[model samples]
Target: MATPRPFSRFEFLIAWRYLRARRAEGGVSVMTWISLIGIALGVMALIATLAVRAGFRAEFVDTILGANAHTTVYMAPQRIENEFTDDVYVVPGRFSDYEEIAARLAEVPGVTRTAAVVKGQVMASANDASNVAEVFGISRADLEAMPRIVDPATSYGELDRFDEGIAIGAGIARELGVGVGDRIRLIAPEGARTAFGVTPRVNAYEVTYVFSAGRYDIDRTRIYMPLAEAQSYFNREGVVDEIEVFVTDPERVDEWSFPLLAVAGEGAQVWNWRDASGSFLAALDMEDDVMFVILSVLVLIASMNITSGLIMLVKNKGRDIGILRTMGLTEGSVLRVFFLCGAFTGIIGTLAGVFLGVLLALNVENIMAALNALTGGGAWQPEVRGIYRLPAELRAYDILRAVGLSLALSFIVTIFPARRAARMNPVEALRYE
Candidate 1:
């Protein structure tokens, strides 16, 4: 039974012995350790890079979906005459039967919830500045249900209590130098055409809550108000501009959106969240892809070290190779042995790198915090990074791909030196010894 085991251990045993050679036997080559370190660093960088990119994308998607609905059903744009300016006024038409549409959308397979909304653009003014902002008129119930990624401590509960209370984004609040309990003026463009030269509808709303939602654009330009007040203010009572639909699976937005569109018929326009942010998301994806390609070059450079180290190993063990060849070891076996030695280095390096990468990715926030604390809190700044913490999303597929790519390269690079050793003249190799 022990005699039969030699065949199974043949290549691996030789490779392991060569790797463990003592200092008297030329020791472990410095190049071998260098190759291992190189591979480890390259693999770690690739894993960490991919994880951080994924985290950023995931965080952005969640923030966007939380502030806005998964799918929105609104009226198609229509052209009309503007009495105020005698110009063509193209506007988003309103849907009067929003309740019916909401009810039908709720019955859709993937649809979980629906809320009617009145959305419009308005001019907002505070003590510090005046800016144009997008306004959402939502029911108290829907407002409560909408996720608040960033909450205002002083005014969080004020929205439900006051009819004229409004929630404004962080950017708007900052720009206006206003906070909870402050007042802002909202002016609607489509005011009644009275003999008094078309008075714009103006209303003062007390800032009730401030939401950040982790997005600067949304924070800069969004205000949420009660649906009833918004309907009255916008002069669209008993009608909502759109029905916002929440789905069970946001990834399958089309499945949820098409059914609502079909129920709402021809005058309806259904827009998924993807359509609104496709370009931004695409740019992020492309950046991740490009970064992956660039980082892979580091791994390729590390693989070259393996090639060099293997070439050195073959030269140093020329006599050993000749002895093995005379002892019934075929050229194929010799090649396999050298390949195994290099593969061992890659495998070990990759495993260590993966472990280190996962640890770093999972605790990046803590590490950054520690770094800041150690450096007196100025070394790592969130304001400069445009995000609060480093986001890391460890994906299994990405890790596996990185490891496979590194291993394949390591194996291929070993082939050249391995072949040279395998084809050596056994007689000449032993003559020097």
Candidate 2:
């Protein structure tokens, strides 16, 4: 008698029938279903986690880069070696000629825009309400160039008249119960020197523009004033605190840092956005890595179900195995048949999981809305998270990683049961029958 090819049509036929067999016929139909569902759920969960993590990173970086300068060149004190004594000495500094410095920096390659900014903290009060806010004094042309502040959907009022007064965040508008054309008093603790020491500077300005930056902290605690007005309010005439640099590619600002400093000249310091937010970005990256490890373990645990199911399947088909062995079925054929059973479960489950996970990622926002309605609100808080909605981005590499992990786990766990079935003794298997 001749042996058929390995994993021949007959072996698959036998495996298929066994999978479909009734429980009364000593089949492991229930275990098969259980294993399939487990792997599918595990894969789905892993994919979902990756999608949300990627989305979160994208959103966070966008928020940081959107509202901030790629880099900032500051007028700071620098140590210079004294020629006679060989001693290092420090001197006070300020960008009195900020326009010239900004122009110099703008001449560098990839530098898109430059603006001199005055920054301070002050108290804002209107309509019986008061709050502390961080103020940035910038020119109207530069403010108009800010995509987030000049957005039509979330901002209103006049950009043309921005030089005349102030542009306040929407959150400030709500807190003070004020609107466009309302007057708000700003009080600075460090004010002009007088005969009786120093007095706080108090001045009121009309709200010329109302803007919503879509970030909780910025919208709540930020104010924008015209550059000259800010300079006067801050008591810093003919000078700015720092010059903000906007680059074509913010992510690659490190490449331009040296050149920026070179053009900025002596006693100047260049600080990029990444340097300012490095700790925050590092924390996010670490969390994402941890989540991937945790979710991958979940997929591994779910794959363990395949081992138990296949073992039960091997035990149940002992009598059939004995008869097949006696009729000249080889050990390799038996192994292939049983291995194919688990492989089928793995492939199908992985496909199903990919489908469900992609679907979940695509509809996550809608689902979040539905959950919020069902729970009567409080599902997500933009104030706490600094984001208005949950974002999910399904990446192809992430999906492939999940599928590869699930299938690899399935194939590995199926080996022992398949081997056991292949090595079974025909005489012992038939003895109880």
Candidate 3:
């Protein structure tokens, strides 16, 4: 006597035969194709969306951490009493002890480097064109410490003779049609005190270096001069406006803030990059979540097609199922066969989608290049978002999420139609045939 077992070879053979059956023979070949295509498209969309989102996030963060400081220390608000008048007065705080403060802050466990910086707003002119620029008076040593600006591949010109001249951004060079060794004039509104009146001070300097920060705004407006020159031009002779600090890990910037404040002493304020870019980061996260939900719905809709297709398959094969039941085939065996049909479509569609999505994500830059070549101009502009292009980066977590969600939906939807086919009475199924 032979004992029956579940998911036997006979069950799979029946399922394979029904899957290959022609429409004229009451097969669900057409529905299977439709369901497979829908799921493939849905999964492809999810993978592509996630890859692009991760790319955007990484680019933004890199530009922030590489080109700018992780945290900045500024003079805190101060209030003083007027002894002569017995009236309270507010005096602007200046960091005369900036060097001492910088030394103490550098000792903080996570701190990597610190630089005293003087900033001033002035009108920059060259080639008879003028634009507003934010001038930073930084020492040559500090300027070279910046990874993005000092890199030879990304930046143009030499910083060795930085003290004698100025370093301007690549965007500024393009705006004013100036280049290395080109003459650019900076006009300060508050000039030397004269007996008659105050006049704007106009000074000329040769552009010794030009750098790209990979950010449109930073590259457009930043000009670096020697600390001494900036102090003289801005009439801030001895003190720096603030001290910019870099750290080992920018993500833990908040944790370092308290330690920084302790060393910075009284009348000092510390602000991290997050404080400056919080709103934009929050909006990006919200947009990512919304897109995921919308695309997941698309995937869910695609998986539902599996249910519809399997139901039609069960109805069409009713007579065959009735005959098999009379031939001593159990209901469980019938259910397994129908389940296999739906599972085949889901599994194959998912695998195809993964392959297609990965291809698109990895070759996104190549695709953009092809588009630009065809158009004889850039197909995508970086002006709006301030980066090179829309890059895609695939993460293992995201890929796994897509695969798990798709398979789960596919298996859950396949069960109902499969169970219905198994529960049908042989008499009723044969009567309909």
Computed on alpha carbons, the lDDT of every model, listed in order, comes to: 0.83, 0.87, 0.87
* lDDT (10s digit) by residue, model 1, range 1-433: 1223332586788898887756855534677888889988889999988998999888778877877899888888889998898899787688888888789878888788999999889999999689899999988788777774334542243655545599898888988999889999999898666887768888888998877777667777899888998888888889898999999989778776567888888888889899988898999999999999998999999989988888888888999999988987788888888888888888888887788888888988787788888999786554554444567899999899889888988888888988998898899999978
Q: Give the TM-score of candidate 2.
A: 0.91
TM-score of each: 0.88, 0.91, 0.93
Local accuracy of candidate 3 as per-residue lDDT tens digits, 77-179: 5788889989987755668888899888888898999999998888999998998999998999999999878879878887998998999988899999999
Clashes by residue pair, model 2 = none
Residues 4-64 of candidate 2: C-alpha lDDT, one tens digit per residue: 9888898888888777868585447777888888888888888988898888778777766
> Which one wins by TM-score: 1 or 2?
2
Backbone clash count, each prediction separately: 0, 0, 0
Query: For residue 173, what is the lDDT in candidate 2?
Result: 90
Steric clash count of candidate 2: 0
Query: How would the candidate models be sorted by TM-score, starting from the highest?
Result: 3, 2, 1
